[model samples]
Target: MARAPKTPPIPPDARAVLGRFETRGPVRSRPMFGGHGVWCDDRFVAIVFRGVLYLKVDGETRPLFEAAGCSPFRMSADRPSRLAFYTLPAGVNAGSDDLEPWLDRALDAAST
Candidate 1:
């Protein structure tokens, strides 16, 4: 059997963004499909795939992403598409400012 791919180290900016949620608990890291799944209170909030962060939020957060013009991850050409994950746009990747709200949404979704 093939081993699950290991996730890369958390980026400095991403670590800073996660620090804001320290009250929630230390972020848990797990390997997932050549990426990392970050969790709070044992719930998945975001994923780092190929050095890009993707927030996991449900339908209610769709408008926020739409307004930001963020796009959903297209995992592959032949698989059924998934919509609960949104990619951070190019220019916004390195800062905690653009990521906090989305992180909040993902945490909210994960909590309840």
Candidate 2:
């Protein structure tokens, strides 16, 4: 029998990241994959892993993320599995409304 992998604690910065989505309504975070999974109004919308933020993407939004130079989330070098979530671009402004557009897209992706 194998023991279950230990669940990683939520990163400290997860709070700040969650703060950015507050206006989206009832946003929250839970420990996952050595970071946190972000939810808005009970729907998973994004992830905060290894100190980086990633938003959910779908077929329609994938090209947009790619065009923005955002890369998909990879578990690790040893485990190269990729997820649909893409990293938040460096140009996004956390302190301003610049993140709204991206967050809106992520929320839309989560809905569908």
RMSD of each: 2.9, 2.9
Q: Write the per-residue lDDT of candidate 1 for residues 1-112, one digit (tens) a residue.
A: 9986556787877666666666777778777777777888788887766666777767787677767887765566567446477775556644546655666787886765
lDDT for model 2 comes to: 0.78
Best-matching candidate per TM-score? 2
Clashes of 2: 0
- Count steric clashes of candidate 1: 0
Overall lDDT per candidate, in order of appearance: 0.70, 0.78
Reference-based lDDT, residue 80, model 1: 45
For model 2, the superposed segments whose C-alpha errors exceed 4 Å read 1-14
Error of 1 at 68 (Å): 0.7
Tens digit per residue, CA lDDT, model 2, 23-96? 77898788786777889988799887777778999889889889989978877866655567997776675665
* CA RMSD (A), model 1: 2.9
